[model samples]
Target chain A: MDAIVVSRLTKHYGAALAVSDISFSVPAGSTLGLLGGNGAGKTTTIAMLLGLLLPTSGSIRILGHDMARDRFAALARMNFSSPYVALPHRLSVTENLRVYAHLYDVPNTERRIRELADELDLHELLDRPAGELSAGQKTRVALAKSLINRPDVLLLDEPTASLDPDTGDMVRGWLERYRAATGCTFLLASHNMAEVERLCSDVLMLKRGAIVDRGTPGELLDRYQRDGLEEVFLDIARDRRPEMVP
Target chain B: MRPALRRVWGMVYRHLALYRRSWPRLLELAYWPTFQMLIWGFTASFFAQRLGNGGAAGVGVAAMGMLLSGVLLWEVALRTQMGLAVGFLEEIWSRNLGHVFVSPLRPWELVAALIVMSVLRMLGGVLPAVLLAWALYAFDLFAPGPVVVLFIANLMVMGWSVSLGVVSLILRHGAGAEALAWTVLFGLTPFSAVFYPVAVLPAYLRPVAWALPSSHVFEGMRAVIGPDAIGPDAIGPGAILWHELAWATGLNLAWLAAACLLFAGQFKAARTRGALLSIGE
Candidate 1:
């Protein structure tokens, strides 16, 4: 069964259309990449999926529960993380994680915290306030928080945006390992084409609040007659029609 | 523990942990209430001595007690409102509302956690003032007897109602409306009859003052602590106390229900506007 299923999703901010009617599904345990430039409705779509923003019209089902009527049930098995949203600055990493663990009702909380601490390399930062951490450190802590529940589905917005190349690669590797170990479904929205190509089994390209093109990364590269997703992304973003293959 | 209560506690613990590590944050909770108590306590003493010089020592003592009680009880309402408003603001400032609302935590569960935190913060801030009023002024806020509990409880409910209104405003208008959190109750103070009886207001304003549950509470405080209660044997708070208490309770219930409705509507509006995720920004 699909971990997430969105049907006829649309959102309007006053008279302005933010997300037009769009529909897609992510099967359980698969990673799907959502690519768009700013204001392409990626954030709005993600927000609607998380039930943070009510769609003007449409329905969302996550893990077999309707978001409108039974969001809390699905929310218990899902988690979201974004660089734009932060944990409390004054809280220590451990305090933040513990609070989320409790919020998620994770049993054996301390042991789970210790395990995440080890995996996220948060030992040195556990006692330090979140506001004091460097950007890369904060990203790792945010990741740890998102995983505190051992969610079946994770929605990540720019999961590795601020990291240096080495740290970014390391986080990507950790995410790869995490998925391998847990079979967690991922819905990732990011500007990094390389990250999407490396991780996403399927890709959805959004423009002006509508899905413009979608396929596997290799298929997109071939269809656009490009060497990489970046070139394909540029073509789509610039509204260049893909070359016809006869 | 039940999962729902555990979630509420987790939210409460998040705020408590902030105070646990930060002495400044802890101290801030008590500072204003203590300072307000000191200032008002001394002012009440001066007026009492003036009344004593006029051959009304008995009335003077009673007035002093009532004034001090007014100051302390008013602080209860102020602190409770601030506690709840500031707790909600903390989530917005941290940009944590997105994370919070996305979890299994329901809107009502968040409200429950906030109510608990408000009471805890109220105690942290007001207990110090209560202790100082007793230690320095020999003013027992509890002198009005068991009815004092009812008085404080009524004020707390009123505070929560006002805070809900303020939070709803913040939700609808975003951070630009945050000043209402601190200043809204103060705007109601004159109309609340905190330092005086509703009778003292001009005829047109008396009805406005009487509309506030807090006015009834303060009026009730005066009735229980009036000059007739000079001796221990004369310390019976009569039917007037119960009459005022009933009015306060009924009004508080009405106000609380209205505030809750307003908050629910605003919360829905916030979700529609996508304000919850971007409020602080």
Candidate 2:
């Protein structure tokens, strides 16, 4: 079963088109990379899927629930994280987690919090206010929050955007383990080609509010005649469309 | 507990945690109301002494009671409105509204949580002023009897209604419209007749004053306080009190409905525009 299915989704901001008739689906337990430049509608697509933004047209179904009519049910089974968004600054990490645990209606709240703390290595930072945390620390806390409910689906936008190389690798490894352990579906939006190549089984490249191409990392590399996704991304972004071998 | 109520409680808990740890936040809640009480209290004392010098000590005491009551009760409406608006603004300021809406919590559940938070904050701010009014000046806000509860309920509903309107404006126009949250109700005060009877308004503005539920509430308060509290022309205090109360209730119902509708419409527009994720200071 597919965990997410978006059909011809279109969004416009007045006369400006933010997302234009994009369609895709992610199989249950699979990781799908959304690769794009700035204002490529990656965030807009994610927002619509999360029911935070209304689509100008088209439909979204998550875990078989239609986002327009039955979003709350689907939302209960899904969660998202972004470095750009933040938890309340005044709230401690524990308080923030406790609040989200309750919001998600997680049973055994304290036990779940402890489990996340252990997994995220947040024991030292649990008492610290969210605003005081460094960018790296905030990213971990956000990841912990996204997993608080043990969601069937998780959306991540720039999951490691600000982390140092070592910390970013650690986070990427953690995500791999978490996905393997729970078989949770992931829709990751990132400019980090290495992160996408390492984690995404398949990737969709977006440009100007539409999907320009899609394939596995290996397949895209071969098609673009490049050794890395960054080179392929540069080619696509610079409008250097290679001819199809077929 | 049901999941919906738990979600509401979760939102409430988030704000409660902010207050619990921060002394400055807690102090801010009570500071303005107390300060307003002291200013009005001293002013009322001066007027009462003037009336006593004219050999109308009874009138002076009655006037003082009315002034003090008006100050305290107006704070209820003001604080309640601010409580709800500021609670919402905190989410925006922290850039947490997207995180909140992405949760399973419904919009109505958020509204319920905010209403509960507003009442908590209103009591936190106004209760101290009530105590000080009684302690420093022999004025008991509760002296007019159980009817005071009805007055408070009406004013609180009015406060929530006004807040709903302010929140809707913010949703439509973003943070640029936030000043309305603090200043809108103050603009309405001239028409609310808080410290004076509605009859004192210019004849042409009487209908405009009567249109607001608060005017009815204050008028009812004066009628219940004494026979001539409003004026000698005041007839049948019981009838006037009940009449004003009825008007207040009806007007509040209409205002609340309109405010809810306005908020719902603007909320939908915000979603379509993707403002929820982007709106913040």
Candidate 3:
């Protein structure tokens, strides 16, 4: 079954269409990369899927539960992450994770916490408050938080936007392994073409609230006759739509 | 229900840790309220003692009545204001509101965490303010009796009432609502019957005062400590305490329910139309 089914989702902010009618689905255990520049309605789409933003029209079925009416069912099995938001700065990394651990009612809390800490290299920072951590450390903590519950549906926004290359590569590697082990589904929104190319099995390029193009990384590269995903993104951002080739 | 409350407790723990870590800034935040209470309490108590009836401790219970209830009303206003300002707005400063909401935490859990933290602030500051008063005039800090319980309940409801109103305003606007919250409070203070008795209010404004839950707080507190005691009768052992207790309990419940409804509507508006997240995001 598809892990996420967004059917013609539209979000209107007064007269401005933040996310025009758009539709897509993510198969369980697969990854879909949502690539867009600023104001491309990327966050809006992610928010709607998370039930953080209500759609003006259409429906969202996440994990086979209707988001509009039965969001709790989906939310219970789902989680999201973004570096822009943070865990309480004053709480130690352990404290922050403990809160979420209790929140999800994760059984055998200590074990799960230890596992995530070891996996995320957070043991050294466990005693430090989350606010005191550097940007890279914060990203790791957030990643640990997102994985705390072993979520079935994981939606991430710019997961590695500001990370140093090494740290970013490590996080990407961990996500890949985590998904492989759990067969978890993922919807990643990022501007990092390499990350998208490395991780996403499919790509959806958005422009001004609409899906301007979509394909696998190689397919998109071939269709745009471009050397890399970066050139393809530039072509789309500069209003250079690729011609369809049958 | 237990799970939900546990979540709130977890949030409280985190909040306490944050406050401890940021003790410097937190102390600064407490500075204004601490000073406000002492200055206002001393000045009000002085006027009640001299220019009015009995000077300082010599004044009749009428003076005690005004001063006691004034302190209680300020407690309510300060909690409600800071819950919105200090507690909720802290999320904005830390840029953690989005993370909080996206977690397993619900809206009520966050609200409870804010209110409880606000109450703890009272625990830290209220005694010191009362002690300062006790030092000057030698009034017992604990002399307020069961009325003190009523005062705390009153403050909780008032916090809920004002926080809901302010949260609603935040949903429609953004940080602009901060100035508006204080502005609304300043506009409503005189109308709140916080200083003088509600009887002194103008005929038309009487309805306005009656509408505000804080007015009832002052009335209820004064009923216990005033010259007439429980009623037109005398102090009569614990009779005054019982009467004040009944009114505070009943009115606190009403204010709580109303506050819940107000926040419910605000949450609904927030869910749709991009209200929960700040505007222009």
Number of the top DockQ candidate = 2
Compute fnat per model. 0.87, 0.90, 0.54
Q: How would the docking of model 2 be graded? A: high
Looking at candidate 3, what is the lDDT of residue B254? 78
lDDT of every predicted structure (CA atoms): 0.90, 0.92, 0.75
lDDT digits (tens) for residues A41-158 of candidate 2: 8999999999999999999999999999999999999999999999999999999999999999999999998998888889999999999999999999999999999999999999
Measured against the true structure, the TM-scores of the candidates, in listed sequence, are 0.97, 0.98, 0.88
Name model 1 segments beyond 4 Å from true: A244-246, B229-240
Q: A85-157, model 1: which lDDT tens digit per residue?
A: 9999999999999899889999999999899988888899999999999988999899999999999999999
Any residue pairs clashing in model 2, and if so which? none
Q: Please give the TM-score that candidate 2 achieves against the real structure.
A: 0.98
Provide a comma-separated list of chain B TM-scores, one per candidate.
0.95, 0.96, 0.80
* Model 2: per-residue Cα lDDT at residue B255: 96
- Candidate scoring better on TM-score of 1 and 2: 2
True contacts kept of 1: 0.87
lDDT score, candidate 1, position B156: 96
Tens digits of per-residue lDDT for model 3 on B66-147? 6654764575566455654467766765666666666667788788887787777655655566566567656553465756
lDDT of 2 by residue, B127-162 (tens): 999999889997899877789999999999999999
**Which clashing pairs does model 3 show?**
B49-B55, B54-B59
Cα lDDT of model 1 by residue, B30-70, tens digit: 99999989998998889888988999657777878888888
Alpha-carbon deviation at B83 in model 3, angstroms: 3.0
